[model samples]
Target chain A: MLSIKNLHANIEGKEILKGINLEVNAGEVHAIMGPNGSGKSSLASVLAGRENYEVTEGEVWLDGKNLLDMKPEERAREGVFLAFQYPVEIPGVSNINFLRTALSEIRIHRNLPPLSAKEFLKMTKEKQELVEFEAKLANRSLNQGFSGGEKKRNEVFQLAMLDPKLSILDETDSGLDIDALRIVSNGINKLRSADNAFVLITHYQRLLEYIVPDFVHVLYNGQIVRSGTKELALELEEKGYDWLKEELQGQESINTK
Target chain B: MMEKDDMMLDELANKEYEFGFVTDIDMDISEVGLNEDTVRFISAKKNEPQWLLDWRMKGFKAFQKQEMPQWQNFKMPDIDFQSISYYAAPKKQAKYASLDEVDPELLRTFEKLGIPMSEQKQLAGVAVDVVFDSVSVSTTYKEHLNEMGIIFCSISEAVKNHPELVQKYLGTVVPHTDNTFASLNTAVFSDGSFVYIPKGVRCPMELSTYFRINAENTGQFERTLIIADEDSYVSYLEGCTAPMRDENQLHAAVVELIALKGAEIKYSTVQNWYPGDKDGKGGIFNFVTKRGACRGDHSKISWTQVETGSAITWKYPSLILQGDHSSGEFYSVAVTNNMQIADTGTKIHHIGANTKSRIISKGISAGRGQNSYRGLVQMGSKAKNARNFTQCDSLLIGDQCGAHTFPYIESKNNTATIEHEATTSKIGEDQVFYLNQRGIDAEQAIALIVNGYAKEVLNQLPMEFAVEAQKLLSLTLEGSVG
Candidate 1:
């Protein structure tokens, strides 16, 4: 469903992601577990078409379309969804109205009739039951006065609404309690399908226990050091990332000799 | 959307006010001058008493001796009073006792101006008194209000029927010799609405007046006085839209609001007077003197205005907090576009102990327009524990436009607290880019952001009127603001 060849990205003239090549097939969940400052969020932002990042050398193809050439909104219409690590707070704009506008814009781009208000409300009520969400929060301004836990849950709620083909959950468990962590993981698990995929980016393995991924790639120094199964995340959680640094140093010494 | 529009001064000539056209009604006009004779002519025509005529004569003399005011951010050719016909009333075919009896042509004129007197009563959820050219043609909901002990009618009628009430409060807030324009309006002011809410009664409905200047070269000097007796309350709204004219038409009116002990008065205006073409050819020179006095303890007065579509607007809706524990407030949104200039603000005087005042002003300027807010807040010696807060913000759309704020605070009381804040910035391009990334077109994004900026003021309007006014604001700046 997605392919990237030597994707090099930087922000503010500082290189972050260097020569990142990855591929994800349908029905496969890929987990990118990395240490701090491992260029994990930068990779997600660049793929989401955030304007600040400059892709110095790379090509990204999503289902045969040039994903890098599209604007953020166009990428959104083409089913590239990034559950932001920190959602922007837009004051004086209701959550429901913003969601409806986004939905209508995507529908218009795809030559579909705008969803009727009744249908939209019905869908909202259906998805709202996943987390037993309080409906009052929907009427408030977007992300304003929301707790850290509530903001993360609301991002998942938006993800459920948009139902993107390829989803990237960036640090979705950074600021969640155990219960909220379970709820967010369950919400993502229910949405996963053979035609859809998710990239769960996290620093700890605690979230991996709930939303177990098919594969985990260790990212260190802006490069994937080792690719392995779910056991890799548990191994890093046990010993720490210094073992990976030692492993990368040993590999570089071998290549030089 | 359309590749960014460059500044187009070529279409300036074509942007003349489409509604600035002179009507063909035969007018019984005063002679082409203003003097003691003109004052007497007006007082006599209205059958004024001797004392009233003396007051008019005094005001006429004051107006003659006084020079035009030069203490503001406005410049205009000296007003030739001799060139303006002071009193220009429509020649009625006959006296009409009912709304239908009045000329549909005249009512249709109001209709074309979007101020149907009948509908403003029936549809707009308010009573409307239409002052066309000079005379109050009709007043709606007067009888209904009278049942509630509310005397709502025209000023001229008030002088005839409620003589004592009119005489007692007419110039109490805004005196005849207050200024040049006030003196002129006091001398020959033809007609305006008057409301008197009796003690202990709340006005059941909003009272409104629609002023239209239709005749050519006619100066509209209307006087409106509203008196709320002890413990009474009333909300009044002033709305106006004028026909397009080439020469600058003088509109010097006076409105006085008096709220007795424990009384409250709220006045609002959506003034869309005729603004000239883009190059500023002709429009309404609206120099109005509107002031309110809280004469009794616990009284309150508030003024909220949305002023746009004027060539040169020079008015300050002010309040005098004279009673103990009284309150004053001014909330305004003034927009100047296409060579329009507005020097508008408010003044509050805290004369009694425990008085409070608040002022919030938002100014938007575009296309060579100039807008300014000049305000004053005073805490007198007797005003112990007085407080005031003011916030003035400006949004500049075109680089050539100007936005300014001048706030004057005077505090002699030791226990007074006053805070003022202001900010100025043009609509940034990065904001537009962000909204565009969210799938909104440029215009939609601009509308959303501008509406958000003006949310505080728009929320003060009634629900239905707020929706219409929001749509009007967008329509007024459809092609230009972004």
Candidate 2:
């Protein structure tokens, strides 16, 4: 469903994502784990068409369409969803109103008729229950004065409402407590289907323990160094990333000689 | 990406003014110039009584001695009084008995303005007094209102039919000598609406006035006076629009509202006059003086205005709380796009004990527009335990626009309590991007954010006007992002 070939990106004239290559079929979950500055978030931003990140090289294809040529809004309409690391707080815009606008715009872009008010409320209520989001928060200003746990839950709620083809969770579990992590994971687990895909970008294996991935890839210095199964996450969690850093340094020395 | 955003801002700022069509109608236009004769000419044209003429003559003398104000935030343009025709009215001077007697062309003009008189009568439950150029052409539901001892008619008609009431409250709230513009309006004012609600009666419908500036080179100086008697309540609304012209048109007017004992009055305005082209070549220079006086104990007055047009706007709708326990409220949303400049706010004076006032102002600036909110809240020595609360917020879209706030508070009584809050913020790029990532375009995103920012003020408007104000805000700042 998604393909990225030799993707290179830069921010402020400094390379961030250096020649990233990845591919995933439908119904697959991929986890990219790395150290602090391995460009995990940068990869998500580039795929979501953030304006500041200049893609200097590479092509990204989503289902057959060139994703890089589209605007951020167009990319969203093409079913690319990025759960931001820090969700913006927009005061005065009701969360329900924002969701309605997004849903209508996406539906219009896909040549689908808009949902009636009754149907929309029903869907909202059902999704709110599915994510266990407080009903009162749905009518309040968009994410204003929300707690860290509530914000992550709102993101999952939006993910459920938008029903995107490919979802990228960028550090979704970084600020969550154990309970919030379990709830968010439960929402994502229930939302998983054969027609959708997920990419979990995290620094620790804590989130992986909740929603185990089919493939785990170790990212180092803007490149994927190793690919393995779920057991690899436990191994890296116990050993730490220092061993991987030393191994990469040894490989560089050998190449120079 | 920045260049692309800039291009979109330029396109949004350069959008054409929608209400800029000239209405072709014969007009009785006065010769250019302002002098003693001009005042006498207007007074004699209206066939005013001797006392009224004397009052105008006094106003003219006051205007002659006063100088143009210098303390406004924006630079004032030099206006040549002699070059502007003081009065212009439709040739059909007689009042229309019904919609059938009104000219088709004039009706079409109002039709284009979205307020067809024939339809308005049946649809909005709003009694409209249609003021074309300078004269009141038709007043709907006057007879219906008269059944309840309510007097709703043109000011000129009121002068002839109800002289005592007109003379008693004409300048009671905003005297002619208050300022240069007020003096000028009092001296050469043509015609506007005059509403009087009798004691103990609640007005059944909204009273409205639609002012259209169609005649070229003419200044619209209309005067409005509304008096709510003891135990009465009334809500009044006014809307103004002008055609496109290469030369600036002056609109200097005065509005006076009086609330007697146990009375309440709510006045709302949606001013959408022509704001000129992107280069700011020509538009209306709106200088208005609107004031309401709570004359008796327990009276209340509220002012809600959405000002989205005019190249240069200098207005401050004020309140004088002279009655003990009286309250005043002002809610305004001022939007300036392209090269427009607006400096507007409110003033509340607490003269009696335990008076109260509240002010909420929101200013939005886009393109090269500059918006300023200047407000004053004064508590007199006798105003013991008086209270005032003010909130001023400014939102800027695009890097070229500007927003400013100036608030003045004076409290002479130690028992008085006053609180003021102010904030200035730019439309965050991240906010727009976040919305865009959810499938909403940048234009829609900006509009959503702005409408939300101004929601507090917009909620104060009447239902029908609130919808229009929301649409106007979106249209004024469409796609304008920094």
The model with the greatest TM-score is 2
- Which runs in model 2 stand beyond 4 Å of their true positions? B97-101, B120-123
> For residues B404-469, could you state the per-residue lDDT of candidate 1 as single tens digits?
888999989889999999988776555544444455554555566566667788777766556655
Model 1 interface RMSD, one decimal: 4.0
What is candidate 2's lDDT per residue for B1-482, written digit by digit as tens? 67977898778867888877888889898899999899899988889999899989889999999999999998999999889999787888758777888888888888888885775465668888888888888888887899999999989999999999998888878887999999999899999989999999999998988898888889999899999999999999898778888899999989999999999999999998899889988999999999999999999999999999999999999999999999999999999988999999999999999999999999999989999999999999999999999999999887888999999999899999999999998888889999998999988998899989998988888888788888888877876883
Candidate 1 has an fnat equal to 0.17
lDDT of 2 by residue, A128-203 (tens): 9998888898889999999988888899999999999999999999899999999999999999899999999998
lDDT of each: 0.82, 0.91
DockQ of 1: 0.17
